[model samples]
Target: MSGLDIDRAAATQMAQKYRNAAEDLESALGGLPASVDGGIASGVLADIVSTLAQNAADLAVLSRVMGGVIDATVSDATATDDSVSESFGGLTLPGEEAAP
Candidate 1:
């Protein structure tokens, strides 16, 4: 399917998967102890936690954006321009022609 196509079921499923993974990371990070061993080990743990937190945030944003992508676009039949498909990496949905 085209990226811009409204595959609601697949989108919902993917969003749910992303959310679950983000939530799992969040829980793991939250449950981590305040400190590891000493010096380098502590720094390493801090870095790992930071990275995980960032990934979780990114995934959450992606999940929301996936759903929002469907909401933010005009239906192909009603759209007056090729701008939408062009915006999505130039991938036109089935039955849409690239503007001349």
Candidate 2:
């Protein structure tokens, strides 16, 4: 009934969606042939590779969005905490950190 409760619920749902998308990407990647045979047409192989690449890109974007939502929810929950401070030592805009 409160804003925090709603944010928590939404964060949970976003996490679940991200998990499902990751699983689907894994399954699709696993289903692809390890190597294409000489008999197979190059165009077919190219198409498969293209599709896989697109799926990977889509998953990456979904992950970014989900991460943003989770971070926003956490920030909202922690807004009143006195000990917490916002800092970006290594994290980039895309949710990854630069290697030290």
lDDT of candidates 1 onward, in order: 0.62, 0.67
Candidate 1 structure, TM-score to reference: 0.43
After superposition, which runs of candidate 1 have C-alpha atoms over 4 Å from their true positions? 1-4, 39-100
* lDDT digits (tens) for residues 1-100 of candidate 1: 3444456566556656756665665676577666666576888888887776777767766766664554444334236345645567656689999755
**Deviation (Å) of 44 in candidate 2:** 5.3
Model 2's number of clashes is 0
lDDT of the structure predicted as candidate 2 = 0.67
Shift in Å, residue 83, candidate 1: 20
Please, what are the lDDT tens digits per residue for candidate 2 over residues 3-100? 43445666777776776676677667667765666465876887788787777868866776786677676666767443333454445667666757
**Winning model by lDDT:** 2
Off by over 4 Å in 2: 1-6, 37-40, 47-51, 54-65, 68-72, 75-100
Q: How many angstroms is residue 28 displaced in model 2 relative to the true structure, after the best TM-score fit?
A: 1.9
